[model samples]
Target: MAYSKLCITLLTVVIFMLAANPDVAVANEATDELQRQIDSLVRRIEELEKRAGQSLNVPPAMAATGAASAGNGALQIGLSGLFAGGGSSVDNDALSRLQGGAHDPNQNGFVVQNVELSIGATVDPYFDAKAHLIFQIDSDGETVVELEEAFFTTRSLPGGLQIKGGQYFTEFGRQNKRHPHSWSFVDQPVVLSRFFGGDGLRGQGARLSWLTPTDWYSELIVGLQNAKGETMTSFLNAPGEEIGGHTLLDRDARRFGDLLYTARWLNGFDLSDTISMNLGVSGLWGPNASGDNTDTRIVGTDWYMKWLPARTQRGFPFVSWHTEVLWRQYEAGDLGIADRETLRDWGMFTQALWGFKPGWVAGLRWEYATADGDTATDPLRDTRKRLSPNLTWYPTEYSKLRLQYSRDWTEHLVDGSADTLWLQVEFGIGSHAAHVF
Candidate 1:
């Protein structure tokens, strides 16, 4: 009996000693902390998988992290500022035409390219919403505020279908839907500026997208939007604008055919463990304000490919190529009018980027644009060619510095060509959504 009592007392003493031991307590706490961390990671992975299944493209590296950080039902707010300093061989007025893009830097000195505020959130199980507000300082030193995009997208739908509506960018091409802060180059593509106006094509609209059940990723998108705005450059632009020598009139949408109709079929393929590709064809048809019965049609194709090693660090040491070709047909006047004519124009741009190391990228772009007939004197329709090379360095995921040089060849320029150099800087704060692949 005495031995049994002594054994029990000794065991109790050992238990008390262990409970008081700092190392043991620390070990217990560490185990609990590890469990908590594992739970968090598991939750994040599940959320990411859910998003991947719903999204059209898989985001890379830091972008995925940003999306995950937003968490379910939480709002994400981000602000980004872009600034540029540059000089061009031509005067400011001529440079404006060369730059073409509303967001591009057009003057010889410092310019505030874009300041944007973005807010997004998952509204519920059925919907997600986002908005972007843009602020810029024009050459006249006037502050301009614009509602870039405000849209809602379906979160859950049957049969792999989704709908988006409200004021938004038309998904005419990969680049058209991207914001200025997401562009690889410091400026917008020359072809996009010419066809979609200084601002990329966007308007109040609704779109439906279907994610087909295929071995590889495939999606079909159809959209209907108002056709009469400055953003619809090839269609019913604002009054006083002239296209193909035909003055635009104040035209209203009298029928469903007067609205812009857009369609795109996009496909994605995993060519190999280390490479991926996306190919898409798009079309737009709508009424034009050039004449009472005239119309316009635009078609385009885009191809994108990226090569990464089976292993990557910070999504670095990769190569990507993107190309887009566009053609436009414009009916300039009434069929019975003496000056009636059918005008055709086409343009293409190709660009490649090499991420040689973490946060460092080198890029080159080539562009060519021309139209049928003797349009050499018309800045918008003339034969224009440009070559641009740029280098970018990202100090961190949220800040970057870039320098670019462009050589322009255009028939409308007095010098026949021009050289321009620009240095750009951008910084962002808060959680920004991941860019699409």
Candidate 2:
């Protein structure tokens, strides 16, 4: 009896010990699973932070430390470019204009060509920076390159106001920002030459623009420009100049070396969304455009309209027109000196673009101009006229082919006239922010 009682008591004691420590087994099983989940969460958080840093273009360490450096604040990087080349001809008896030689062809010694590159990025939701570079070569393979523009912009203001700084194109007319590559026509209207002196309108300046929000779009721009324009020293006989023989705008003498101003206003409304029209009026006032101390002032307007219907089963068709009239007021006209100021300058031009296909377009342009400066003695008596027509075909989003015919009339340096006809082949592309023209 004593032995049995002892054995029973021992077994009861063992069972009690096991029951008291039941939580130990459960904790061991749950702890491993919970620990695994915690580790995964930590790794996931680290990856997310890394990606966020990259999106801001911020250095990972800097991001982690929460510092906003200028180089690391960009949100997106943009790239754009163009390449265009074609042949040209004019009548032998017509006035032959020697454009920036890079656009010359062998037949007429005036081929068409263009090459451009641009880089842009948004530093923040409301701030941006842009840079444009150009490389153009004539049919003879002579090259001329330029820095088209470089500017920084910010829009952190009330009523969508934006401030721009650095060298920029004046918003005097449509073509300042109206890139030829983005245009449907192969050539610009004649008015641009009279109003803004074509590409010479580019200037070193600062501009401030305010864009108002609404279905009716509106914007205002003011510019303070360097009246000397593109310096002849940067492009000419100063040595190392690759201008296919000569540069375009600098053929004339220096006009203004200081304070030149330009201002523009834009207003437009949505013509049922698919079709729209905009009107821009601009003015530029400055001194001595011809280096004769004869103050020069010009004013003009630009109109743009687009038409796109909801249904176009037969591809897409649209028409566009650009026109301008300019009257250059000369403070000192009809001076007796041989190289003296002789007359006021005035000219008018209009052009149209028609789309035959999504990427194909046809264009026509015409202009009449009379400048008192052509002949240093009789700047006004000289009348210059141009008539141009062009057709283009695009095989892809990045390529274009164009054909153009034109006539010119100028009674300047030569006699009656000279003209010719030309056929050209052109290739273009937009990639990697660089162009080959």
Candidate 3:
């Protein structure tokens, strides 16, 4: 009888509290609604996974919270800032030739390498879109703004086919499409700077990619873009620019054949449980401004290999090697002209990175470039080589610190060689997409 009276008293107290506090009843109802929504999202995700025959691997809490916030056509915005401070053995004027990349830290003091604003989102069910805008202060303290990339890609296409359009980086090589923040080292490769100019071959274009249904991963990409611009270094670059002793003319794309044509075939394989590799070949063809009838052709091949142990801590303890070789043939003058000749240039860069622990990576790179001529006096075509060693530490996913040293050798420099040391820092905010491997 005493136990029955105690239970009656507790029930009466709960009823009295609920009656006195109306907010508690509303809070309980809201929580139930949120739980229902989470359950619905889980079911939808499971259904999608079943259809795709692969696990999305999304944690339940993430799906219910962060992922849900991005649902229903919400836009994602991100900003990244990269800065560097360093000194070179040579003066700033001479350092410009050695550090050829536009974004590379060329001066002997502090530099704002890149400040990028990235925006991306899904456009309904058929397409996805993204844009990158860059802001930088030049050596002369002039603020410059540029539309780095603005592109849209098809979301779901049949037969593993996809189409991309608008101003985009040409799918020429592994490094061409990567942005400055994604680079393993602070500076661009010497060969790439010479061939693609400091901007790395980007223009208004459209491309089609096909994912082959092979056992091993394989992809074929073809693109067509306007071949006249400063970025099209091997093609119709800016007027007054000299290449191979030939002054570039103001050339415009008058027909489809004048546009740049690009093709690439990339393949990936798993050598073992702990090893993976990617091999690719790329080519470009376009008209040159050296003469009305002159043209340019470029070909390149790239290889990458990575090794990781079975167990990892935050993707630590891995080694990766990357190498690329490129060749270019330029028709310097019109056929039948007295000065007509073909200019042949080739270059290669190989780099290796060791992730010795979580958030720490050490890297070394070697580069070589030359042309088939007496180009000792020409900075662009002269024989050049460089070695760079760098160490990077990532304190968090959104921030990093790096230190690098580069030793450069060139025929055009009076000293024949130079050394450079750089310290770089980077930070990001907002939801940035993961970079491509």
Candidate 4:
């Protein structure tokens, strides 16, 4: 095993060395650094394995969830980081995770930044909990302190109700609920990116959810949050905040009731022990958006289905079809508009996920939107459409790497029309944070 390990390390070093220089002796600086880290991790794991065989010298790493395993559950700990920089036709949310990458000419370029460290425990009775410290890299190259998520839960909630608190996701959209690093592209869809902005926020409040008790698995969630709104540099120079650059209004600012609801169901038909067709519906609703106040509301929904067919003796092949719609309505959007009353927008997204290999999935997405009644500057007053092809590779249970390309075209605009071609690559890592809902 050690010999094989040596070979892997040596191989990576060789590749990087070759890329460095054509005449220089093979000296892989970057690869060497990475290999050393991986080798150290492997050595530690090997030592732990050997000790377990003879006598327990050290405790096993617990799973991030801290839930005792049906299969010798062990405590698991992990570390992760990412850097992304990319250019684009417009500054959207799709490339939210990647740090440095090429982009379009007309679009704005942003540095992808996030530093996360987390720890968790897996306890007996199928329960687990985790705590995370999230560091956000702002556009102005400033570091911000925020609590990402901290929660625990059982693998299977009997009554389908999973209760969670502390800072975590707000259940706005499937993508919103998940970390940005897990996305295929560096940016999110236009609607989501435009509507939600970034990080969104973890309402330091509470969340409740219920799952189906049937063979058809389904889950529903209701969350009440404590927010002043999104967090960022202040936007207003009013009496309260300091000199503001970018102000995030939707932190936990639910005057009437900052609430969110989400529901999803899966209908799986067994086609042999390992093959099946899984179908379902998912949706989310809440008061969200940059300008929306207590009386305003933003809601979203998704309808989807998937087919998993036995393609190879040792490989699984599957494809999914899904659509999502998001809408935002503001009660009074007039900072200074005439008879300013309501501003509403909703967009639709449909995509398919096809498993090309055991750990590789490739798919495409089509998004469209129609905005009704907006300030004279509403670019989407007519309608919008775009298509994106995304590919993803999950190397382990805890990490994923993705790339995507998209073309956006629109007729209506606040001023001139804009067309864009965008590309993105992203890597996601983190098995240490799990806030169950």
Candidate 5:
């Protein structure tokens, strides 16, 4: 009789809990403790039923739960790397030296593209933190280590707002905010390399984001960052140097107004139960390295769309597409008595990926860039276009292999074109976070 009463009481409590919290059984990384307690109670109840010559059944929803981290602390460490080899026309080895290329070195032959290590943890109920370190080979053929990102983000803030501080990638465009390993292509687009620097726009900064109250997903973001560094291609206020007996930009002669400022508006919405799309607009402005206080401005638009079946087992027959267009204006000040010029340039790229089967994906991309002002002397600003097709196979969530082929065309340059074939291998270990959608 006592066991019967206990069982009845437990059932009543379970019903009440479910009624009060319908999501109590929702799977999450931090709910392992709750799941354990539930399992113990179910086991005891089953033992009681067996003794009473009765069988007890548990619902699958109550029996299955996600596993949490086994570590004592909240800290997590993850590592990812890419090694690539191929041949490029026009001897890209020389270009890679000048640009400090991101992702693949864009060089001939084999090279270790880069190795990245990430550490992250929740600081408390209100904050979380992350740090990323990158190791790569520099122009001098020396291995160099750099702190790519280290920032603290707010976990809870009023009015659907959040704040981030410290060094990080600025949300200037869709691709700038992504890590190299997450890129669809072997190298960054020509426009990104020419305007934002080969490494993608990033620096010490503070960012504030707000999720607007609406039926669809919408966000507004703004950031202020130090306008100095190799990544600061548009506003690289470097140290003073004598060029033809004239002083180049002097770092000491800088002002607060020279800081890089960025703003972006992003909107996302579902087209159907199985499809979604996102649209974004971004702008960046800052003073240029020309000590004369010349400035640079860039504006861009981005779009992304994805379609996947709702009840697919392995998420096959999926399609992902994205594109971005950028326009930039640069003022370099007077380099010569006869030259005081403002240059305009533009670039755009579109890509699509199709997952025809589980663990395999095929994609194609096209990119174009041109300088409206002049491309005669500046190879970086020259008119260029490329078409690339790639195939990727994933053995598991943590490892991937890819093969890509590209045909690059440069108008007005020696040889005017090149061909490249790239083989890339990537693997990740330890708690890795999902990439941004």
Candidate 6:
């Protein structure tokens, strides 16, 4: 502190001396040299102060915006939100419960769908971490918070291999790994909801993925997760109830081998300069939590193709088509007066999205499912189908407005047909990572 003051005093003295003795050539030249030295010292002091200010956290926004420089790069922190409100005309509680209950499409009223917060940063030379939190309104119109995803991924691995560990969405099908806000439409496909529940299957586990050295993009992924949670519809190993002097299966009685296991193979092809396509096949198997120690298995196939003209590729007016088909089998012991039985259920959905102009897109989707088994209260027993068409306007990369209409048909269930119209607006306040392709 004393040296800084002394230097300032010396600089002021030289400036005054130079002004008072302008005619003295020798003194003027010496003073000019002194001035240069003083200027350099002042700049060095300013740099020291700037670095000190950073260490002291003088500006909070720098940290909040993830602009603070760290070892290798700036620390990353971000928050985003989605608010959805729309009315439905189906107006039948029973049908709503049958379809999705609280997340049903037939329910009439305004509701908040999702408000998400995401944060992430590199932990060290070996790994990086991220967490996504979600908030929404429950069936009783109460606010609730849910942890959507929290995981750590390996940063430096050899042989084109990567590892991830945490509670995350499994890569079972095309759209299960994505959040609702990132979906092309307002609701998930009917098949996904019926097969994996409203929230796609996710649990605490570790995943390993390897990229093959092939001409076309090829990769394989495998994972093992705890076979529990309400989202595990076909394999919840909890205790069952007693109805009419009969007890359902108990999942806890099974061994650890009953844990859910998943695997997927992905491949991509560049059909031409203006077109590309992706194909994938996935499978999930685990023991059903029912006390009977029965097992469940599910298989899925997905395909996606996109086309863009070479001339407008930058601003990219593009058309894309995606489709997924799923099949599930459940084996169970005697629940009634019968022997062992195997029931099969399957569903498929196809969609197309066209970007006719910049920031404007339109899409159409068709979904169908059926359960070919003998069960009196099987939700998937009847033929269920829905057709939806939607229009969307993206004001920017971080915000969008969408309007959609859907017509649903239930073949065997009573009062099984309905129509619904929806409007949604979504925006983000902070930086967010891009969605998976």
Model 4, which residues run further than 4 Å from truth? 1-75, 89-110, 123-127, 154-158, 212-215, 231-294, 311-316, 333-338, 374-383, 393-401, 410-437
lDDT of each: 0.82, 0.52, 0.82, 0.48, 0.71, 0.68
Off by over 4 Å in 1: 1-68
Q: Root-mean-square deviation of each candidate, in angstroms?
A: 17.3, 24.3, 16.5, 8.8, 15.5, 18.0
The positional error of residue 336 in candidate 2, measured at the CA in angstroms, is 12
Q: Per-residue lDDT for 337-401 in model 6, tens only?
A: 37556768889999999999988889999988888754334454567888999998887776677
Model 5, residue pairs in steric clash: none
lDDT of 6 at 5: 38
Predicted structure 1, TM vs. truth = 0.84
Screening candidate 1 with a backbone cut-off below 3 angstroms (N, C-alpha, C), the clashing residue pairs are none
Q: Which ten residues in a row have the lowest lDDT in candidate 3?
A: 2-11
- How many residue pairs clash (N, CA or C atoms closer than 3 angstroms) in each of the candidate models, in the order given? 0, 21, 0, 47, 0, 6
Where does the lowest 10-residue lDDT sum fall in candidate 1? Answer: 2-11
Give me the overall lDDT of model 2: 0.52
Better of 2 and 6 by TM-score: 6
Q: What is the lDDT of candidate 4?
A: 0.48
Measured with C-alpha atoms, the lDDT of residue 362 in candidate 3 is 99
Model 2 lDDT-worst window of ten:
232-241
The collision pairs in model 6 are 237-289, 249-290, 249-291, 250-290, 250-291, 251-289
Q: For residues 1-437, could you state the per-residue lDDT of candidate 1 as single tens digits? A: 32223223332332333234334222223434333433443344345434443453435554446543767577776666676766788988999999989999888766668877778899889999999988777787666778999999998999989999999999987899898888999899888998899999999999999999998999999999999899999888999999878899989999999999999999999999999999999999999999888899999999999999977889999999999999999999888999899999999999999999999999999999999999988889999999999999988787777889999999999999999988777766556557677
lDDT of 4 at 157: 61
Q: How far is candidate 4 from the true structure (C-alpha RMSD, Å)?
A: 8.8
lDDT of 3 by residue, 94-149 (tens): 99878888889888766668877777899979999999987776788666778899
Steric clash count of candidate 3: 0
Better of 1 and 4 by lDDT: 1
